[model samples]
Target: MLLNMNFIVKALLGLCLVNSAFSARILFVMIAPSLSHHIFFRHLIKELSFRGHDVVSISPDPMNDPKLTNITEIDIHTETYDAFDARKWLETVQYNKPSSEISLMRSFLPLFYTQADNVLSAPKVQELIQNKNEHFDLVIVEMLMFNAHLFALRERFNCPAIGLASLDTSLNAMDAIGNPTDPNYYGSFFTEFSGGNLSFWERLQLLWHHIDFRLYYYLEYLPISDAMIAKHFNITDKTAWDLEKSVDLILTNTNPIFHIPRPKVPNYIDIGGMHMRERKPLPKDLKQFLDDSKQGVIYFSLGSNVKSTNLPAEKRAAILNVFRQLPYNILWKWENDTLPDKPANVLIKSWLPQQDVLDHPNLKAFITQGGIQSMEEAIRSNVPLICMPFGGDQKFNARRIADLGIGRRLPFDDITADTFLDAITDVASNPKYKKSITKLASVLWDQPTKPLDRAVWWVEYVIRHGGAKHLRSPAADFPWYKYLMLDIIGFILAVVIIALIVIIKVIKLLFRIIPLKKIKLKEQ
Candidate 1:
């Protein structure tokens, strides 16, 4: 009896130890206050918490609702930018050309540097790091904008970190891990599609743009980042600043069907449709609106950054006039209550449940500014789109969707009631658009598991496997010259030059010897 009790106690202790070892605490950092980014991170946090992981999020504000109980919120106020005023910057960009934009970005680098500095220098960030009593097993960081925060956390925690790219994980993070972005892939930020096929001068401009990016990141961004990390962690021997070195895994919120094939590192996981999970319930009014709309519904949203209310009066009037004439009920995600005129068929609200509205069976078409999250939701729900891309990556995303035959792009400046009506009419009346969307939806869903599930499972898998060291890409350690294949090409060119030189010398020597021998024979 005594022996059995002792054995049971020992077994219980071992089990407890095992359980403790397997448990993980993950910290998520997000900088953007945009709704799309927030929603993506919110779903990920919820999924992680559901899997019994301790998840903490650091962002400008706690965007997640109160329902997400398990996730702790750390509020860090980074520099705020008016997304509306960006239109002025963009107008300047267009007028001055790409080189001017590069120069503008170079000028703007100091602002981002200052923002990163402030966030890192905050008392809360410092307190979090110094509080040795608090412990974390892993760090998940949103890899948009500045990477300074990520580096700071990695150096401070010295734990395995993962990157969560809210947009398609093609260029920025994937490039860091040796995955070359395919120029043919239209949606990739690095592709010719991003800047359009350029002439020699334009190409030079693009090159300058890239160089500008590198310079800004290395000179302004990296030093501030490294300084923060060193100050907090007390590490003096910092060498290179490779973001891939700081992260153990990268989970992209992009679907494979939408992206071109590229070599994926072991640690890189594509979890594109992670935001398509079903919510518990729709608001009663929204539900009734969907049910009441016998003629089907058209959803119009400019995403988080570009507000419809903020549009110039002419543009706003054009859209309003178009919406009034449309036969279908319009659910406009308007940020303001007062508009010039409200049509009987139009429902204007400060905000709407975007995913929920998209999921409604009556939702026939989406008129959008071509945000990736909105596009993903429309694709997932088999709804066609009329893309009016304003700026930034929206143009690329709009073009890709249009190329897929599931959508059409209309420039915001060129928008008129007739054009808007015609575009919306075509998307609604045409069976081809619905067919294409449905086909893509089938492809998106054909996977063994849902995207959100895969994301959740993999995040937990990282935790269970003791920080997923196997997923770290070896290319992260390679020198830039080697990673870019410049060194290999240089070596090959050098060898060819040396061989040509040797051959030329040998030929000259033979010619000289033969002439001398001929002379000697003639003399004899």
Candidate 2:
């Protein structure tokens, strides 16, 4: 009997070793604590596991899912930054003017620097790098993750890395590759939308911001990141580590159909619809409510960070008043219990299965803060939107959706019951909005394979190909000025100025000589 037990234990141990050997290991690093940002990568991770990849995620907390059998969680806690709590900060700036609000937000940029610094300095990260046996073939890191981690892993593990950005891929990541962001838009390299359509003042603002970003990167983020990498990895050769050497591919969560035309680098892949795939069963009660409601459901969520309950009293009252009148059954993602006045049409819950709700046939419209992930889901579900954008890129995303003719934008402060009613009524009654969203949905979902499959395939491709070296951008060797076309512009400007001065001098000399010759001839 003792021998039988011993034999069973040995067999089990052997099976475990064999399973570990065959499993393809992947390391995914994300810096987002907010649910919105984390949601963007959830499907991608699941898909990797589905494809038989052993996925390890470095995140602030473990994912709530029980079926994520292959996923291992690594804690990466970030320092609490004031800017991250935008809702609380906005309350402090309530009395301030719009310009003041914008200025204050800019001033708080240091918070991100501090947060990044704290994340990069975490001892766990250093320990992970030191564990020589736990090497990853490919490292998929969020853009907000310390850039130093990318550098250190490439130098230490000698593995290829890819960037996953929740926002539209900007110049910061694209410039690492050969692609350049457009300057006319906020993320654009040449454009500034001070108030839309480049004016002289707008041009100056754009130029100033461009210079500011470059300076901030060099003076603050780069130096701090470099120091962290050096300290963690004990590397002195700074020149050897470049963004290009570290990042082989960039996967942006932005659809090309929504963005303006721009040159795409070979290494940059726009896998926007990766997060929009169908989810499993919704909660029974929620699913039943949606099915029972003869009228379409109006889904309201302020996203993960900013709670609707935290809104100012007047704003909350205004929202409640609007909700009271809406005929549609409301699924409000209210984090707090006991709203002052509850409407019969409204069903308030601390949380809702957002994607599942969106996927439901009864969901008529999404009333949102226009977070990109939410917007993408709404688009995927062919649901029109009433976007009351709060802050940051929400405004930009709202405008984008409105521009696409699938939604309407209502400022949070200015939203009234009438406006809300009108917007919802218009979206529900008008077939065009639904038609447009349906069109976008088709475009977003028309890929040859599932987005998850594609994402997982590429991840494995990078691992199998030993870091996709063929896709690495050659431009990583260039300086910032060279990458931005500033160097070329500066040279051209200098040459033009010199030529103008030379021409002026020649004109003056010719005039003086001609007059002198005329006088001499007349006297003779």
Candidate 3:
């Protein structure tokens, strides 16, 4: 019996060894120049490297982790800042809005394509690709914007590819993996409607959103991205369209806690809150500030992309006036070195440990820019929010917070003392906001395992199973008409038409042969 037990143990140990032997070499071509995007991809690489996978990460920001042994950080220089200016973006998006739908679509394409062009044009990226001996098992591309350009990397390596989206689940991204975009219920990227029955107008807006986005992609976005990738890579065998279509799996930064109800296939994984980490002790001054506050502390941040310092002087004064009047001590993330008038209650820091601040015991409410990452941290900390969104999916995210009954949206244009006071007071003082936020926090936290663990497991699963092709739906391969069953509908309609035509011909022939006069006499 002892010998039998030993045998079993030995067999299990050997099996473990066999599984551990399959250490993969992964290439993370993360060229997103945003800090939030960089942080998420950096977390992923760290997790993968911790599990003994050799990782080559091409990113603007590098985590020079002495602890992580299996990772190579290739520092990349992208002209994202040179190409796109956030302060300018804020000015245009807020003050001078696009005139038409075409103008809106045209306005946004450059922000993404500029990053694409710059990343591909980077010296290190070109070097990494041109190297003949450097091989990888899989390539993970940060695909928030243009996916087709990065798909060229997969073509070069002849390996499986996976996409990572920094934003919420995108319909175009889902389309790449063959998931259905049921626009009937699925909110548009900016509408940010939570799960509820939509009004007729809302449904029409969704339908129009679907139509407009698809039209924009095909007519304006697709051609530009395709030409860029082809010209840069000298792509010969397949079109840029095929390159994007060949992607195996896409990981979205959306959880059921935050996202509306949408059907996703196996290939589409939700690894939301992967960037979340254990909170560290706050700085001494910050801790003291929070602890000493008679009321609670309000944490305000505009996230990484948009700097709070860029706010016009008048706007700053308006917000400051409100903060001065409030009982709460406000920790504002100000980007500049110095300011003229200092409010006594407001502490202006060029940078902040945002999650730690939100986790404080004296936290009454969060005043935020409605970035998804900040919203996730607030939820995790069970802090209610007063959102002021700028652009992109921030509008949707803010609306979602309001829809969940956990927060209120205050427009930047209307940031007067009274409006700010009302919004902040409502979110902070209300029991319902706390209750709703806490409930969702509990739900979001109650996972089978850590989100990071799930993400790593799926990443390994893809590598182990050779690209998750079985998980890929046939809908991905289908043309638009076939996927929507328009062809099938057309065929059915054609058969019905043919049947009607034959029946009409038979009636006419009978009327010609059989005398109508005799039929009339018989009736008489």
Q: Report the number of the highest-TM-score candidate.
A: 3
List candidate 1 stretches off by more than 4 Å. 1-21, 63-68, 77-104, 170-172, 182-187, 190-212, 231-234, 239-244, 279-281
lDDT of 3: 0.81
What does candidate 3 score in Cα RMSD to the true structure? 3.5
lDDT of 1 at 370: 80
Residues 137-227 of candidate 2 have per-residue lDDT tens digits of: 7788786423443556666766788878776754456656667554554443112132345566666766666666555554545665666
lDDT of 1 by residue, 341-429 (tens): 88888888888878888889999899998877888888878999999876556766777787789988887667887888899999998
Instruction: Choose 2 or 3, whichever is better by TM-score.
Output: 3
Clashes of each: 1, 8, 0
Assess the local accuracy of residue 400 in candidate 3 as a C-alpha lDDT between 0 and 100.
86
Backbone clash pairs in model 3 (N, Cα, C under 3 Å; residues 3+ apart or in different chains), count? 0
Assess candidate 2 and give its TM-score to the true structure.
Answer: 0.83
Of 1 and 2, the candidate ahead on lDDT is 1
Model 3 clash pairs are none
Question: TM-score, each model?
Answer: 0.86, 0.83, 0.92
Model 2 misplacement above 4 A: 1-23, 64-69, 77-106, 117-123, 145-150, 185-208, 239-245, 279-281, 484-524
Worst 10 residues of 3 by lDDT: 187-196
